[model samples]
Target: MPNSTLHPLASLPNLGPRTAWFLDEIGVATEADLRRLGAVDAYRRLKFQFGRQISLNALYALAGAIENRDWRSFNEEEKAQLRAKVEG
Candidate 1:
């Protein structure tokens, strides 16, 4: 049988078993699935389901993983753009 594990997605922080299970329940079992939902929807869903705000740091991590960019190195303008993308 195939390995079946989502290796790349598993590397993201805070994406342990519980979060993974939540994502699966939301029909998002991979990085691509999360990315397809876009940042705003992803955050809203997570917040609503988990009953806690997802932090900017967590957002950065998820975005970085999806876009294959270094989120930590994003400039203020870039960060603003990301925030705008999520908020709008």
Candidate 2:
């Protein structure tokens, strides 16, 4: 059984240990924190902190987690939009 008190980000789909660690490094400890930061801003922080260590997939996963969807489920257009947001 899963721990009842696990951080929501830890339990979210498409996010794994590495991603959780990255989120932690960026000070995102709770679901509320992630929600407040939003995926784009969160990705920006990760990029700013980790630089080339972070990937676009991390952005996809963050967005998927926020929307309660799988990262792989994102269509090309959706992925493009995310890329644009990150680059914009």
Give the number of colliding residue pairs in candidate 2. 0
Model 1: residues >4 Å from true position, as ranges?
Answer: 1-8, 12-22
TM-score of each: 0.65, 0.88
lDDT of each: 0.65, 0.87
Candidate 2: residue 64 Cα off by (Å): 0.2
Candidate 1 lDDT over 1-58, as tens digits, reads 2233554456665454555555665577777788789656775677677665456755
lDDT of 2 by residue, 1-88 (tens): 2333455577898887677778888999777889899999999999999999999999999999999999999999999999999889
Error of 2 at 42 (Å): 0.3
Estimate candidate 1's alpha-carbon lDDT, on a 0 to 1 scale: 0.65
Off by over 4 Å in 2: 1-7
lDDT of 1 at 11: 63
